[model samples]
Target: MASTSSGGTVELSGFFADLVRCETRLYNALNDRLRERHGIVTSQFEALRYLRDHPGSRVADLAAEFAIGIGATSKTIDRLEKQGWAARQPNPADRRSSLLALTDNGTQLVGAAEKTFTAEVAELIGGTLDSSSATAAAQALSKLRSVLERNQIGTPTG
Candidate 1:
C-alpha cells in the first residue's frame, strides 16, 4: 500500500504535488513530441544543443551537466555520431577524453527543431500571459531553478 506524506498541512503538499505532476507531464509531452517529430530524444537534443553552443565540450563535462552516468552519456554521443549529428575529436589537452561538437547537419537540425519547439510552447501559453508577464514568469522560473540547484534537489536527469 502507498501512503501519502504531506509536506505539512494542506498548503505545501498540494503545491508540491501539482508541481511534480506538471513536471512529469511536461517532460513526457516535450520528449515524445520532439522525438516523434525530429527523431531526436530530449536528452540527445540537449546534448546537441550544448555542443552546438559550446563547440568543444568533453563527455565527462556533459555527463556531469546531465547528471547521468558516463556510459549512458557515451551511448548518447555514439547515437548522435552514428546519425552524423555530432563528432568527437581528440582533445589537445587530454588524450583520454575527447571533445564533442555538433556537425553542420546537427546545428541545422537543432536550429529548426528549437524554433519548432519554441513556437509550440509559445502557442500553448501565449494567449494566457502578456509579454511582460511572460518575461517575469521566465525570470521567476530561472530563479526557482537556481534555488533548486543550490539546494541540490530536483536536479536534471539525463
Candidate 2:
C-alpha cells in the first residue's frame, strides 16, 4: 500500500481531522461514564437535559437544537419517557407537534448525572482549563459553528 506522510493516515483536511478526533475522544470518554453511572447514552442525557432546562420545548425544537433527525430525536425522547424522566404534552401552539418537559424524576436524575459528568470532565482536563479558558473555548466553538452554518459548510446533526 502506498503511503504519503502523516503515518499513512487517510487524507483529511486539518479542520475535519481535528473535529473527528475531538468528537471521538470526547464521546468515548463521556459514553463510558454515562453508561456506567446512569445506563444512558450521551445523546439520551442531552435530550433530557434540554427538556429539563426548556420546560415546554417542542420536540421539533429540541431536534433542531441537537441537529438530529426527527425520528432519531423522537426515539431518544421515547426512551426518556419510558424511563419516567420526561413527559410530552400537546404543543397547544401546534396540534401536530408535542411539547417536551422533564418529569420530576427526570429532573432529579439528570441533575445528579450532570454533577457526575461535570466532575469527570473537571478531572480529565484538570487545571488545564480554568473558567476563563473554558468560556473562551465555548465562545470560539460557537463562533466556528455560526460560520459553518452561515456558509452551509456543516449543519449540526444533533
Q: TM-scores of all models?
A: 0.76, 0.80
Q: Which candidate has the highest lDDT of all?
A: 1
The collision pairs in model 2 are 66-158, 67-157, 67-158
Which lDDT values do the candidates have, in the order given? Answer: 0.80, 0.80
Model 2 lDDT per residue over 1-158, tens place:
33365546544477567767877887788889999998887888888888877889877777777766778878888888899999889887788988888889898889988987898788766556788878977896899788876775644544
- Cα lDDT of model 1 by residue, 52-75, tens digit: 888899987887777677888899
TM-score of 1: 0.76
Report clash pairs, candidate 1.
Answer: none
Error of 1 at 72 (Å): 2.2
**Candidate 2 TM-score, C-alpha based:** 0.80
